[model samples]
Target chain A: MEQRRSFLKMIGLSVLGTIIGRAIIGREMLWLMLSKLTKVQAAEAPKQYGMVIDLRRCIGCHACSMACKLENNQPTGLVDGELETPNRRINWSIVLGREDGEQEKGKYPLLSKRFLPRTCMHCIDPPCTKVCPVDATYRRPEDGIVVVNYDRCIGCRYCMSACPYGARYFNWKKPDLGRPENPQVPVRPVGVVEKCTFCKHRIERGLEPACVETCLGRARIFGELSDPNSKVSKLIRERGAFRLLEDYDTKPSWYYLPW
Target chain B: MTNIEDVILNQLTKTTKRFYAFIGALLVMVAWGAFAWSIQLTRGLAVTGMNIPVYWGVYISNFVFLIGISHAGIAISAAVRLLRLELYRPLTRMAELLTIISLMLAAMNIVFDLGRPDRVLNMVFFADLSSPLVWDFISVSTYFILSTAYLFLGMREDLSRLADRLPGRRWLYKALSAGWSGSEQQRFGQERVLRWMAIIILPVMVSVHTTVAWIFGLQIAKPIWHESGLGPYFVTGAIVSGISMVTVIAWILRRLLGWGKFFTLEIFRGLGNFLRAVLLIYAYFMIAEQVTIRYGGESASLEVLEFYSTGAYAPYFWSFVILGTVIPFLILCIPRTRSIGGIVLASILVTVFMWVKRVIIIIPALMHPVLPPGIGMSTGIYAPTWVEWSILGGSYALGALLYTIFMKFFPIIDLEIGK
Candidate 1:
């Protein structure tokens, strides 16, 4: 035990010595990798892009869900490994809410619940992307979406717990599929996890997400928020929309409004 | 008296029938579980009752619980050994055994949550270095590897002594012994490695559990998962729960294998004291976790927190607190109550109760969905599919199988067996 302690001291001194030596040398590999790269001198930086979802226009029809399923070949109700109870179907499940105590006078109770279509919240501060040990899950570079590279996941389900909104799902069993499946959203295998991508497939092909196009209620809205004239931008400017679990500071792209 | 030469020759003997019978039972369970998993594969997550509202279910909870159970190895091998507590000498082997098997079991159990196990390697092929799950993979795999090597080195000297008696297995002993002649230098070198490993393993094992908690702690999910207490609290609960599992196994091994002569009452008394300490620490943390959650903005969490106190999953929750915490502490801490019988009972309770605790922690939070625009909270009640249950049963069988095989190849009680 005494010898081991001495060995630790020796290692510690060497590490300190190395650090001091590097400091005296001005710039080391550390400077190149840690400091200088982000200075924007030698490297060209692409846009840090994202999408905005307007909750006010969504109807509960699940056009986005069906589109994602057809596009991604997502089995009816499973993502990652978790199995869904029937009738609780989702990929992008929809929720409708109303303020309490609004009595339906006569023909009034037939109002459509305010549709809130949800999938991966795609938070600016993504906790789900940080906890995957094998790096099977990550935030994509071109876009700010935390996507699962199903082939690499060791099936630990660490990301499942990290997402506050229950956005991620695991492939607990082998995923079912039709042959020559949708080329865009690859049906994942059992033992990996998957989640919503804001219809990255359609977005990649220069098309609006199936959900955005399919919304008969026009409640589902998606677009680049950076282009101030975008429809999503126009709506957000007109009505103050908010994300879920705002206190966590996840800075989600999906937002809801009372209108 | 036998010569020193004769003493070293005894380990060659093959394992007896009792070992085979034990392993046979475990194999049957593994087979059943694998079959169930296959069924789950053909069908989808639809086989299980999990849904949008209650997304995670039994499988995720079991994964956490089993990892906690694996903490027994560090508590026994590192803690007791570091203190130079001689009572742990006879039991260290089994505890180490428990760690290796439990780690494997916990890793595999995650499959119950995977949509695609085939692509599990995507983590390696095109990986994301920034993910917490990635860190979890690296940490757990490291723990698994280090523990295995440590166990191997620790058992080397003993295996050397059992060589000649091993009959047809002299070469097996020779390889493990690295031709150890039990010289003072060899003992000193082995001891050096063991001590180093124990020192490093203590932190590694603790970190492993903490990382497991981080898998949930990092989540923005609910009050239960998103707490500062999630890390240390989980580590404490795991160690406490783990010791009891070790105690139960020790008791069973002593009785079934006629190991009583070496697994003495002194060891039992020492284990009792140690387990009591574990339980006390656990109780303190359990209370701290609950109190902190209750006081914090538990309601605002994406998942419900207070629901645990009165919702559908309440019994499993309270019972876990009682069984894993209250009862075990009360039994083990009392002076007159710290008997072998008391310890054994508490051990059994902690193991079973802590499992219930794991379920409550995982399911209730998951069940309390943060409803979306069109989605109403489906009354999230999930009864695990038959495949899920079978896989769980199979896991227990896998553990038992490994233990039995280990005993067959390596004698259950050695060195002090006949003394």
Candidate 2:
């Protein structure tokens, strides 16, 4: 009788221990889930900023690219009147020109040319932010704007490899801005990766991004993408715009209107 | 029978002129590498050939190769112990020592590749769990600690035995032995602990290589790198490279230390056959990976495939297959050519070309981006600068130096196996 009672007591203790462990673990898991859910909810709070580029109106002039460079105080690739290699330069916004013979429109004699103005798409589910080892890059929860914490970056460049659009650039050397520095924008140090931030500073101050503001063709539009009545949202809903690499399902906030 | 203990003790005590020359050469290479690194630190990574698109280059490839080589311990020592393969008993210490040295070198390569080496500690303070790089850091560090402990514990008995005999290094041995007297109770406890460590280390080894693979595989940006089979592929490749390294090291030790009796022809043949089998499995994975990409016919992945098979990188890709896999396989397969010298030669080729394989894995993927480069953008050219090469050479010399120094102080072959 005594032996049986001891065995029963042992089983009771183990069961009680298991229950307590389960309760604690379950509570922690619940807290984690709740915290993640709240972050998602906050991200979806209808203030998500985005951009739309109407390719039909684009003239391939590269005014916006120049504006971005000047605004960001980016290196110009010119050193002692000798142009540095393209890889050595940093351009947050670039106009990619696809020349004739690549995509012939009607026949061999007639060829079509297309100009693609590329920048950081600022995706809702960003691959670059996900791959940062130091949590240096992240999508802001409030406005869904992706940003990089330059101070925290270890400059491993995993984010550079993770970006599908090739939007990110690394500061290989010290910035040699021949022009005066932009006091509004902090110059990135050598060795850290930098990218287009959708002009987070300008947007926060109710000013449009330099690229959008300086676009001579009026091709670029910036507004709240989540708001149904916003210009970018209306352009997407009405004109059937497409995001680049749609098959990847990154859910990029930036869209382009077909020519 | 030859007294193995006396032979090892003699090797430890005696310092030959040739050994000093070898160590001297290694130190010079190390110094050159340090000089190159100093230049890089002052100027920046711009001194290296890594440009806009090809942000990673030889350093990353060397990092992966060294990590793969570090698996020698897991493949030879721990697995041999678990399987009770007594033929490989003499090789366990050498393999473990290689693991420690190569792992340290591999980690240094990461530091070398970093843009901001000063901010490396930020990885710990601001670690992001979602990143595959963090996973790799965690797993590699865990494996390093565990393997170091495992190696130390396995050497405890030998250290205790050497403590009494070697007066000059008595304190060092005594401290390392940790009061081990080889008693019945202590032996039992030690055996149990080592057994548990061996078993536990296997998974950590698998996790280490798997996480390394995920560093590329998890990226949806690079279609060629984003493969489900990458984990298993990298692990199998690591084992093949690791075993090849052990074979090469065993051959060197036999030639230099005159330990031909300990590392006999049978051991070489066994290793050769084992390497052949793993190489075949690795070939299967390679075929499967290529076939899946070709059949799927995705534009980006096919571009990457074409880049390997017929595009700009075709030479490297074909050479890796023919030299690293085919010739080695054939050498290991033919019984007549499976002699000790032939096996060693084949191992050297495999070891060298495995590094080339890692290069093929990294560079080609970056060269072929999903979106083509714009008109004014870089054409994605990469060539490692003198600085990069110097640093790489230095790392290899450093590894050799560490291995040689350790062998001078301790037994390269386990002393208590047959006893």
TM-score of 2: 0.94
Measured over the true interface residues after superposition, the C-alpha RMSD of each candidate is 5.0, 2.7
lDDT of 1 by residue, A1-259 (tens): 9788979997999999988978877566556535421212212113223445554455456676676676666665434334444434435534444335232223556554444457777776676665666666666665666677765666555576567677776654555653458766667765566778777777888887776676677666677655678776776677887777787676776766654
The candidate scoring highest on TM-score is 2
Which residue pairs clash within candidate 2?
Answer: none
TM-score of chain B of 1: 0.91
Using all chains and alpha carbons, the TM-scores for the candidates as numbered come to 0.84, 0.94
A175: Cα error in model 2, Å: 1.5
Candidate closest to the true structure, highest lDDT: 2
The numbered model that scores best in DockQ is 2
Per-residue CA lDDT of candidate 2, range B217-290, in tens? 98889988888899999999998899999999999999999988889999999999989999999999999988
- Give DockQ for candidates 1 onward, in order: 0.40, 0.54
Write the residue-wise lDDT of candidate 1 on B355-392 in tens digits: 88788777776666554323434445767767778988
Instruction: Kindly report the docking quality category of candidate 2.
Output: medium
